[model samples]
Each structure stands twice: as C-alpha cells, then as structure tokens.
Target chain A: MNERPIHVVGGGIAGLVAAITAAEGGAPVVLHEGGARLGGRAVGSAERPWVNLGPHVVFTDGALVRWLRQRRIDVPLCGPMVRGVRMLDDRGARFPFRQGLQLLPTILRREAPVDETFRAWAENTFGDASADLLCRLGGLITYHHDPGALSARFMWDRYRRTALSPDRVRWVAGGWVSLVDALAERARTLGVRIELDDRLTPESLPDAPTVVATKLSGAGRLLERDLSWPGARTALLDVATTADPGWPAVIADVRSDLATCCMIERETAADPAALGEEGGHLIQAQLGVAPGVGVAEGVSRIEDGLDVGFPGWREAVGWRRAQIVVDGTGAVDPPGTTWRDRPSVEQGDDVFLAGDAVAAPGFLSEVSVNSAVQAGRLALDARRRRAFAPGWPTAELTPERRLAVLAAVLPSAELTTTTVPGADEVAPVDETGPGYRIERRAGVTRATAATAGKGGVRVTRVVASALPGVARAAVERLPVWRRPFRR
Target chain B: MENQVRAAQGGDPFAMDALLTELAPWVGRLCSSIALDKGDDAMQETLISVLKNLPTLREPAAFRGWVRRIAVREALRAATGDRAIAVAEMPEVAVAPDFETAVDIRDTLTKLPPSRRAVLVLRYLEDLSEHEVAELLGTPEGTVKSGLHRARESFREHWREA
Candidate 1:
C-alpha cells in the first residue's frame, strides 16, 4: 500500500498540477487522461495558433503561475493591457463596460434582497432596463448564459474575487497548450507516469490514494453517480483574421447573449513560424448560449454576433473552426447551489477531489490549481504519515533535483535570450543580424525581431543580471548563420 | 450476469469491469435520486464500498439488491451529513407555477429536504413500495409512509399556490 502510486484522474490543469506536486513531494504518481491529449478542454491545435478551445488567459499572480515558477518553467506572459470593451445596444451604439469595483458604487446605492436570483436582484435594485444591461454584462463576466438562474450571493462572491484580487490578466506566450505541454513534461520528469486515452473504472483504479480531477460530470460518471450541479454550456469559434482587431480581448453585449472576442495574436508572444507564412491574426470568439439552444443555431448566432461586432468579419476571416462545449468549466453555482454547497477536497479517506468544481479559494482556474495544490499536499501528507512514524526524517528535494525537473520540463521555443552576470548593460551577441535591435536600459536587455510584410512582433527580454549561465547556454545553442530580421 | 459477479468476486479484473459497467448506471440513478446534488460523490463511494465488500456478498444473485442497498446507505449518509434535516421540521417552500413549467424534475426534487426527498425519490422515482423504501432507508414503515405523505403534500401545496 505504501509503495502504490497516487492515481490522478484527468489530464487537465488540475490533474497535471496535482500529479506534479505529489511526485515532487516524494509520492509516486500516475495521471490518467481520457482524451487523446493531456490538455483536456484547454488544448489548442496548429491550425488555431494561440487560441485555445475558448479564450483562456492566466492571471499573473495566479497559483498556476507560482507553481510554474517553483518548477523553474519559463512561460512568457504579456500584459493585462487596458483594451476597449464596449456594450453594444441593438442600434449599434457602443458604451464602455465597467467591471470589478468600478460598478461597486452603483451596487451599494441600490437595495437588493438577500438569497434572490441575480436577475431578480438586479431588476429590484436597478429597475428593468438597467437589469437587462447588468445581467448581460454579468453573463459576459461569469460565462453563464442565463443570469436569472445564477445566485446573487454567488455572483457577488465571484465579482469580489475578480475585482479585488491583485492578480492581473495576462496571456500565456504560446497559448494554453504550451503550458499544458510544459506541465505534462514536468510530470513525466518527476517520475509521474501519464496514461493517455485510458478511462478509469472502479476495478481498473490504481492501488493508491486517488484524486479525481476531471470535470464534475466526468467525475460523476466515473463514480457511477448523478451529480446535480448545474453547468454552463458554450460555443467557441476560432477565427484567423487577416488584419489585427486592435484589442487584446473584449466582452460585448449581443442583445440576446454576451459574446467575448480575444485577439490572440496581439496578446501572445508573436511566433511567425507557429502563425505560419500567411501571418494572419488569430481571434477567438466565445458566445455563451442558453442551455436548450441547439448546437447549430448556437454556432450560427455566435458567428453572426461576431460579424455584427466586427463588420465584414466573414471576408476578413481566413480560417474558422466552431465547437460546442458542454460542462466546459466545473459546476456553476446556481441559485440554490452557492459556494458553500460546493464539494470539499477530501471526498473520502483515500479518495481526494480537485478541479474547478471543488471548493478552493479564488475563482475559475485559480480555484482549479489551488484545489489541486491542496489535494496534492493532502495526498503527500497521507503518504508520509503511512511511510514513517512521527519524528522520522522524510526525503527533501535538493536544488540539483529541482534543476533536473526543470530541464526535462521546459519546452524549447524559437527565440532564445540569455542574461549576463554582474553586468549593468548587456547587448545581443551581434548574431541576431540586421533589423534586430538589442536595447540595454536600467539593467535590462531587450532583443526584438520583426519582419516586413509579415504583420507580427516577437520580443525576447533577457534578464542579464540573473541566471547568466542559463542565458549564455541559450545564446550558444543558436545557429551561427542568422536570418536577417526584417524591419 | 451471476457468473460474472461470481468471477468478479473471485478477483477476475475483466469480470469485475463488466459487472461494474452493467451496474454503474443503475447505481448512479439510485444515488442521484436519493442524494440529489451530491449523487456523484455518493455513487462513487457506494461503488467503492460495494467493490471492497463484493467477496463477502453471500449470494451472488443478490448483487443488484446488494448494490442498491449500499447506494441508498451512501446517499443517505452524503445527503444528511452536517446538512441533515428532521422529518417533522421540514421547511415551508413557496412553489411558483412558472417554476413547475420552467424547471426540470431535478430542480423540484432539490427544493425538498434530503430525507423527505430520499423517501419521495425512492417511492415515486424508483417505484419502490413504502415497505421497501422503509427497509432501504433503515426506517420504520410508518416513518416512510408519513415522510412520503408530507413530501407529496408539500409538493402539491406548492403546485396549489402556483
């Protein structure tokens, strides 16, 4: 029993994080992913470029970011750039959307009854006209199609997390797939075995403490029980545009539903090679549809909404792929099922739970990674308690072991930059060629490469003062003959 | 099916898998109806418990009944733990006609207390007689009858108000 590996079901972010953390903590682990790939719902393809199944952005100070940093995995993150988000009326007039605490004053001035539906609360507080506007905006923010079904208290809790957290939204450099790949690689390096396309059954379960990290519905099915948690259904459209939309991401009111469009090309680290020779911008449009809406109609409505938001969208679109996602996230907190009703991490003595569904601190993906960390720690603690008596010395992770883990995990990117030690100013090694500007300012060296006719920007910043050896190794690995960077 | 159960009890992995696959949906529905929102958790626990105790099941032919019994126990435990409600102290619920028209059966079931809901679900949804529901719930026949009556009355009252 002590030697049995910890079984982590699902290959999503939660499962990956749990497996990695548990393995790192000296627990043998195995991750089983039902899908062909490890990323589960958050995977991206070559055809989609930087856009994931839906528009996914990581908060800079999120638990996932901290976890990645602890593993020494370098995931380049660009800004939470203040972009234009407008609420469009039926007549096409655009009004800037207010989010987070920006609408707190308006909320405080209104009187809303406790334990009411969000729609009812909004209507009671802000009247019918304002309720419609607020509900649509809330739908956009919460990713719920029907705000009427959502709880006001739950909405308030979610709003506080979004508005109050110090963390700012930032795009992962190479889409979510890159992060997923890195996590999978890290799990493998830590001796955590991953079995893809293998579904777990009661009899087939590994002889170990198991953490069920799949979506709520999937977890329910595996356990052979019906889970009554309500979930939001969504349809996602990935569009490759010939021209930039000039905004990193935007949430717009589409009369019937709320539609969110993310300019993946602008947000992510520009990789011309990954984007291909055509060099079109990748835009992801996600529309939250009502539960009963047909998939075909939902897709059409989302496509039409995108067209309305960005006129001539059909002509500008290069490649388009549409998919309908059911139970994409975890169990949503409907009117009766608020945060308190969410399942706990400790499902049983040996069986643990993690994912967006489990009650963890924070919102959405933050809840997922946080719950995974807790679950991993719990499993590790259980393992240690079983392995040794009280006061017994446990194995600790050394710096060398940490490096070994990182080296095996970090994926090689096209652009590489290295830092120099004890140097106030460091420039690119002159091999970057013409049009590649290496600017040194305030103890930082920025190397930028761009090309004419190709509409993209690739910038790599090397923190020369820190991790000089790593930077130097990266620079040495570059080819001797460099392609002339076009300006 | 009996042969498969016997083989599963004898530690044949394939036999166990086949048996569980056949029983999973039935157990899931039973647990879901009883435990409501926490049906999945209850179902998983019930399946695990059943698997652990499979060898001890004296009569292999009684596998369905054995699994059903375990599911009911697990569902009751899940629904009542820390959030238990007394049979007599059921809260007065307002039933809107629109709610009946708009919401699904699961939504209506969720509004009732877990204990009464368990009784109602077992009696009506599972089509179990009062005595069987009583036996499954480990309560007296009178309690089961009274609980079912109260649950139905409450549901009907909500409809009446609507």
Candidate 2:
C-alpha cells in the first residue's frame, strides 16, 4: 500500500519536523498523535493566567529558526538583547540588572530597606536579596527543582549575555501560539498531513523510518520496550490582566522562597500597567501569589491519590491566573545517553528517538527543539540510505514489568498505574498482577483575583505533578473560599 | 515597523510600512512570550534587529520567515546577554505581559519548540513554501523541510491539549 507513507509517532516538535522533512524528501508521511492535536506540551492549559512551557524560546543557531524563515513564518525581529532584569525577594526587596557598566555603579550604591547591613555594591548589580530569591526561583523556573541544588553555571546560563547593549532582547508581535498556527499553515501548504488526538505505539509506524519527540516522560513511554531514562515535572504560572504592568519583557529567575501561601498571593497587587507598558502579555520567573479565602486558594500536592498535601496556597493577585506544577523528576539522563547507547543510525536500526530528554545536559533547555529536529533528520537520512532495521525491541522485561520497575523506582506516594490499550492487565505498583497501571492526578488550581485595576475573573485551574492523593488533600485543605469554584 | 525586505528588494518606503503592519505585532508577541518578565527588552532589541537587518533581506516575498528568525535570534541573544552581566544587585525590570490568550491560532503549534514554532507559523500562516522559508533563513531547503516535519508532529500533539 505504498509503504504506508512513512509513519511518524508522537506529533511533538520533533515529530512534526520529521514529517515535514520526510515529505520534503519525497516520501509521503502519515503522522500519528495519541492526542486530539499537535504541538504537544507547547500549547494549551485548562487554566489561567495562561503561561507556556519555557516561554518557548528559540536561539539563532537552532534549526527551527532557519526552517521558519524558509517557510515565511512572518514576524519582525525584536532584538535578542535584554535591557535589564528586575528581581524581588521574599521580603519584597526589588533589584534590577541592566546593560552596561554605568548602571552597575548606580545599582551598587543602593541600600535595601529590609536590612541596614544590606548595601548594594557595584558588583552586586542584580541585588543580593533578589539573587537569594533567584536561587530558589531559578531552581523551580529553570530546572523544576530548587535552584540551590542546580549548577550555578546552568542557573546563570539563563541570564548571561554576550553584550551590554540595550536592544539585544526581542519578541514576536503575537503570542507564542500565533507562531505555532503559522507553522501549521505552512505544513498544510507543503502537503504535510497533521493529525491530532492520534496517540502512537511502535506498531503504529511503518518500516520506512520514524521519530519520537516529546518530553522525557512521553519519550520514555514510547521507548519503554527499548530503553529507560529519567523523567521530570514542571510548574507554570499563567496570569491574565487588564493593564500593562510596565515590567521588562524578560527577567531573571528570582523565586521568592517565601511561605508557599504568601508566594501564591504575591502578585495580586501587581500593577499591570507597571509590569509592562504593553497589556496582557508577560513572561517572568519567581512569581508569588497570596492565598485568599474563596477562589484564591491553591491546589494540593497529590501522592498516590491520597491527601498527602501542602498548605493551601493563597492569592495575592487580582488577575485571573493558574499555576501548573508537575511532579516528574525529569532528572538529567545518565551521562553518555545518546544514539550511541542504542542502535547506530548507520547500523540500520529503524527505531528512532528524539526530545529534550535525549539532548539536554539537564532536565530541559532551549536546545531541545534542535535535538528533536536533528534526531528526526538523522533518522530520515538513515532510512534513505537503507541504513535502518525495522525491528523494534522485546526484552527481558516486558512493558508491564518495566512499568512495575518504574513504579518501584519512583516515589510511591505520587504514582498509580493502569493498563494501556494493549497491556495484558491493569495493576497498581502494590498489585502482583502480570500487567500494572500507574497514574498521578496532576494538581491544578484555578483562581480569580479582584484587585483594584484588573478585570473580575472567572475560574482558573493550576496544574501540577503530584499524586492524586496529594491533589485531593490539597483540595480539601484549600481555604473555604475556593470550595465553590471547583471545576 | 519597516518592510526591510521590500526596501532591500527595491521597493519604496510604502513596502516597509506594509511589512511593518503585517509583521510587527507577531514579532512583538513572540518576544513578550519568551522574554516574559523581560519582554520589552527583547522586543525592543528584536525591533532594532529587524530595522538594522532589513537592508540585508534579499527577497521581498520571503520577508516573513527571515524576520521571524531574526526575532528569535535577537531574543536568545538578549536572554544570554543578560546572564553574562550577572551582577547580584541589579534591579530586574518588572514583569512583562502574557500574550498567550491575546492572539488565537491553532494549538498544534504549541508542540513545536520555540524555533520550529517560528518556522511553522512562517511557512503556513504566512503562506511561504519551504524554499522561500529557507531563502529568508539563509539555510538549505533540506534543513527547512526537516524542521517542518518535526514541527508538524509537535503541533498534532499540542493541539489535542487545546
């Protein structure tokens, strides 16, 4: 049947790129997505203030930029240089990091009100309080963990720049999704077929070639039969407002290590006009929201569907907002984890893998998209040269066993299991059945802020990686105010 | 907000305006989204990059892809540049805007990494083919094609969540 048009599984960025390249290379491509759409984690959330993963940044050296330009993803060049950074600490101390040495003198001369001993030195341009705050926020925002535990170099990588110029920072005139939409149109024009809600399995693909590109957990699920890798979790804060907050377009990771409840409500009084001159768009790290009685309570941290919970989150912002907190560790893959660890592209192994999990030095990075694209193209090239084998993996441990191992390895409190479509049976980690199931009810919180200047909001859901138990516990622990807003 | 491509390709000032009108908002949104709290810095730099690089664009029709690439590059440069300065006491700019809900498009694009998302948008929404995208990007057609394929898959997955 014409070789089934080179089946591609997992329609994340990497998979999409693979499909495009295959079609361009004169191979008809059919892409399978287990979900209802494409773009994977790059888009959508059930809550608000809606935020994206990684703010979805791209670099000049990456392949995606070149591809977009080739296809005319028309957008202007906002420069890549940031003018400055502003950081706030647990005590509400504010600091700024700006371009050029002149600003250094100004920053160093300042003193904070919280502590008389605190004096800003010329070298302390981002501010000590904020820097301390950044340590925690940087951990959560950049690595989905505490910043103190991460590499300082990696922590600094997010803010380090080559120039002190004012215009190095840039943006797209539209939101991140606009660019995604534009790409979809381009794919359609190239006669590339896209399917949503089409999850994939090994058998779903043809023998020609394939690429699997998603986050670590997703990638692991796809490759459970082939290999094992570490997984990660993420939390995102989405906020919507009526006025421009007059803040910088980008800022450093300044996680306020305040009380969890205080942290949740910290931004409630934020003046949108003061955050940025432009309205309704922002990307920043280390944000906090205070807890309110009603719609303002935070979601819980779930563990094994029981109520092992965190304190109820408070609401500090009046805008409509939600936070997504994932629990997967997403630890860095063991060193030397690469295509070499598996079958060689030149050795004719047909099964291919791609994602941030494969390419990143840590849990995630701006380079993940590049890794996906690179892996897909490499697979295509191998297939074209007849260098791939159609054989998939069957090993000492079956999918069910592997899942069992996974449950055992992970913190038991946060996981539950069920049988997927083809599994022999559905079992929990504690169960002795041949087949098992594991599931975590991600914690999602929706809050409404009624501050002075912002719009009165409806429901918002915060997403987090927690056991279902933790989620339930957090929900019950939620202040009485949020009981009516349950989704 | 100038049509650097048309100008470089021998068009008049009017072309620059058309280009600006068509592309500026999209670029602005992109910068804000990624730059987040620091979007203005990124947006301003991106605009300047666009203005400065306009003269180098060789094709008027391929302007969209080229400009979008430049924006992403500019944003990255900005983020990285800020980190290099790393003074502990600097006042970070306040938070920027959240552009997610402001503009509406297909959810599939979200699956793409930032880079691929740019390509998908340029290729599809802007109606530029692979070669045109490649020309604007100064890369090979093959690279563009490969990126498009992966980006499509990403879109399919993300669209489901939306």
Q: State the lDDT of candidate 1 residue by residue for A1-487, as single tens digits.
A: 2355788999988999889868765568988988778887667764453457766767654456745653456677655645544445576625454433345555344223336887788677767765666566555446667655588766655554445442467766667778888888888888998888999886786654778898877777776665445667777777777865553345364464343221122222233223333556665656667767777887786666566566666777777777777767555677755544777778766677888877665556767787887788677766644432121112222112212222222222123433222332121122112123333233332334332322332333222322356665575454322222312
lDDT of 1 by residue, B2-41 (tens): 6767876775433443344345545666677667767776
Error of 2 at A97 (Å): 4.7
Fnat values, one per model, are: 0.00, 0.00
Clashing pairs in 1: A418-A471, A419-A464
Docking class of 2: incorrect
lDDT string for model 2 (A15-46, tens) is: 66656655544456667777766666655443
Clashes of each: 2, 235
Worst 10 residues of 1 chain A by lDDT: A425-434
**All DockQ scores:** 0.01, 0.01
Residue-by-residue lDDT tens digits, candidate 2, B26-58 = 565455344333445565565555544666766
